[model samples]
Target chain A: MESLLERYRNLVVLLAILVAQIVGLAVQVRRTSAGVNTLDSSDASGVRLIRLWANTVVSPPERLIHSGFGLFAGAWTNYIDLRHVRAQNRDLKQTVDRLRLEEAALLEDARQGQRLEALLGFQEKYIYTTVAAQVYGTSGSDRSHVFYIDKGARDGLKPDMAVITPDGIVGKVRDVFSHTAQVLAVNDTSSGAGVILESTRIRGILRGDVSGRLEVVGILADERIHPGEKVLTAGGDLIFPRGLPVGVVEKVVRDPDRDAFIDVMVRPAAHLERLDEVLVITSTEPRFSPQQQQDLSVSAAEEESVPAAVKDQMKASEIMAEKLPGLIDPNLAPDQQPLHDSSNPNPVVQPPQPLHPDRFSPGSAPDDVPEPDAGSPPDAQPRKPSALPSANGGSTLPGSNSTPEATPQRNL
Target chain B: MALLGADLRRDLEIHRYPLLVYTLVPLTALVLQAWLPRVVGRYDWFDLPLVITIYFALGRRSPIQGTLMGAAMGLFEDALSHNAIGINGIAKTVVGFLAASVGIRIDVENTTVRILLTLGLSLFSSALYLFVNRFLLDLATEWSWLTELLRAVGNALIAVVLFPLLDRLQSRD
Candidate 1:
């Protein structure tokens, strides 16, 4: 026991350690009470100060070890922050793109009505206007340019009617249902429209070519036409109206006198990929007979033949019905009909020049015309005929003569 | 002046009090050492400072001596760790006292026995620390049981290997 007492003298080291721990405990308690994590903050501060002092007073090895540890940890944190920043930047870019698209759509919608007013050259003369639509997506699988329009087929849309953005001609309507119409974009490769150059009055068949441009070939090479000339629709044959923009000459490759033809390439005015709402042409075709065609100088539907201009007049009653909706026959006046039945009255006898019902109406649209793949627009979802299938299916086709005598009296 | 000279001679002879290392060493490590640094390189458990402390401190003369030694190690740990300051201090002190009491009563002079005893004590202490933290205080510790066991084993081996040398140093001083 006496020997043990001698050994107890060595416990001074232990006593010092205990005192140090007790001091640490007290400091931590005070900090914790103040709602601070003293163990973390206080210890970190102490460690940093101690390390700096040790580097000055203690072995260099110890200082090196601490500094190396800190650098490694800091580097790891930087890597994590960099990863998070990259993901956030990608998200921000997508949001900016979406906002710009929305702005373009709103502007396009406002411009459509104004454009029609300008084209008519009379204030509000061509009255029944179209709603603006924007192309949402594309289907790479089916290669369809099905666009989503603000106005559906309900807004007086018919199959085969032309579609064009303000940039210029787009395509004609392939099919029309109650709430949507699938347009064949200008670059669909399966497209042909009549186009004539405004500068040279050079009429040609504007076919959408494989090079994704327009090829306007005139039958008569004798017609002196030049490149860098603007093309407009020569609407005498009533395909597209005269003075509608087709395209400008990109390159003119003139062939030395071959057949009586001048072949020229015209770049399309519309960018099909970035399609928005387009002008769907109202058909103004006159029922021309075979003898009438024989007498005409040009057989092409696009060439402007002189017309005996008749004084076109409208009655006050016709104007009133147009002002008050649902009074005119939709089958006769494609613009006046509502979505449900259009309920336009006596459209068969309404048009001053009535088309032979058999000649004009294509009867019913084939059900097998696969619902233009929705890979393009939400409106283009494949044919699901579960609801109102009968009412919406082929009930109102373009040029359908609705002789009001047989039809029900619907409220205007 | 005579008393002060005597005290200075005693301290100089033993080279005992390393106040900077004992008090501030753990504090510095705590701030600088990242909680979860990249595991690309190897982590040698023997190199851990806490294991070094245990190797030196457990060779203390009595249970009280071990307890005090443990408190120093614990305080350093608390300063660095983002946990309760006194928690490690109390836990380590108790482990020290238990180990010292058991060691003094046994044939601790046998190196093999000393190594085994140190190994067992390290494992038991680490388990006890974890249990007290998780169950009593609701503290979080990660990694699987197998990995934690391996870490304890490494620390124990280090302590066992270094204990005799540290013990001799203390006695020589």
Candidate 2:
């Protein structure tokens, strides 16, 4: 047995080493698989502990070296770049001015759109607040395309929060440590977003393949999708809000493997490779613009005044009915006879434009006819409605005892 | 050239290194591997840890010590990367053992042999890593034979320059 062992010693050692590694790898894979269903932040505690240990060991020296090199490099660049900075600043200022004008125009359009939306009962999701973070480094592997941020749980950052740049959607915060966080870039295989095509408004699921290429699925082959058309967040997943810029369609091909689905490749709007700084959306809620607020107030006031205006107008009608029995057209049916207009017996005193019950104001009803409690001016009463010649040259409201001239005028 | 060959053979003489060098060299290599890509950008393809592991493994020329060194270095790399812990460890251990076994049998003093060994080992490590990730862990890895070949070539070129530089650190005994 000793001789046999000695003869196969090298082979035995190699097999043992491989076996040990394979066993270790199996344990890790089992833990990883078990943890996959939970929140990514809570899932990889064991793996994260190892990561933290390594990062703790590596980062101190890394930070030292980075800062040391950055100091001299920054000083040199600052000095060198300052030469043309003034000219660049001037150009940038002009660009800002132009953008300001464009912003004003956009603001006006947005207000108009909001008003229409209010009328249609549309509710918008607003990016209420965000936390800014600097990207420190990447995962250092092509398979796990994640970037590390300087901000973490300490900075109100949580897992699955949307991270974006001014240009477009970057990704989402996956795992938050004490001082650092991992952002799963949109190009990672596990990362998915609900995306909508801008022009077509056809929504589909955006996902990354094994090759780190982004493709949108679930869009039917028959759907019209043009290259370079914009894509935006649909907010179906609830991680990202609606209407955040996602990417643009690079190509749309009918997927032969799947029936009724087209494979659409997308080019991300944000430069995923060159990300330096990102914003993690901490909270999101509905936003109400100033115009929307004012509209709401106006509508509320109108709602309150509607019943009062109708009551006041009814009181005036009752007073007229009590005072002027003859002026009321007894010949016509009750429904056909005008109720409030009979109070305005003076046809020469032009009746005010009809009040819309929906948008009633106090001043909208006729002011020429005074209330019974209030005294009217002497010349207020004029010719009655009976005085007006019909197009047939006859009195329209006929056989009434009160003639235009003989009609008893109200006490002015 | 004959003198260089003689020197290379003499340089292969096994001698104990100081505790500081044994610890610091590997640590520095790991640190640089993690850091250079951030500053220089696009240097990720240069696997410094693997190179360092190969250098030490070949220098030691003992299969047991070589395997152990590779395993330690590979674990350090795995901790740094977000990947599974033992994937690199397993691949590097196999490479290190084979490299040491090869070093014992062959004339490792030749520069051409050093380049070819590194090139062959780099490819083997990469393939083994992919296999472990794909089949064992069920993790999806993007693989291209062309890309791997190009990277192997790059690592070989770097090894051609680096092995000579690293030779200075070895014992004269």
- DockQ (C-alpha based) per candidate is 0.13, 0.24
Structure candidate 1, residue pairs in collision? A47-B27, A47-B28, A164-A278, A164-A279, A328-A344, A329-A344
Clashing pairs in 2: none
Instruction: Give the number of colliding residue pairs in candidate 2.
Output: 0
Q: Tens digit of lDDT per residue, candidate 2, span A1-412? A: 9998897776677778888878866666543445431112332666678778878877888788788878878987988768899999999999999999999999978975654454233223233577667788999999998999999999999999999876678899999998999999998989999998765567898888778878898888844677888899999998988888988899998877887789889999888988776778888854568888788899998778789879788789777664545444534666666653436565575546664631133343233233433364444644346655777875543322323332234321
Quote the lDDT for A143 in model 1.
46
Query: Best-fitting candidate, measured by DockQ?
Result: 2
Candidate 2 docking class: acceptable
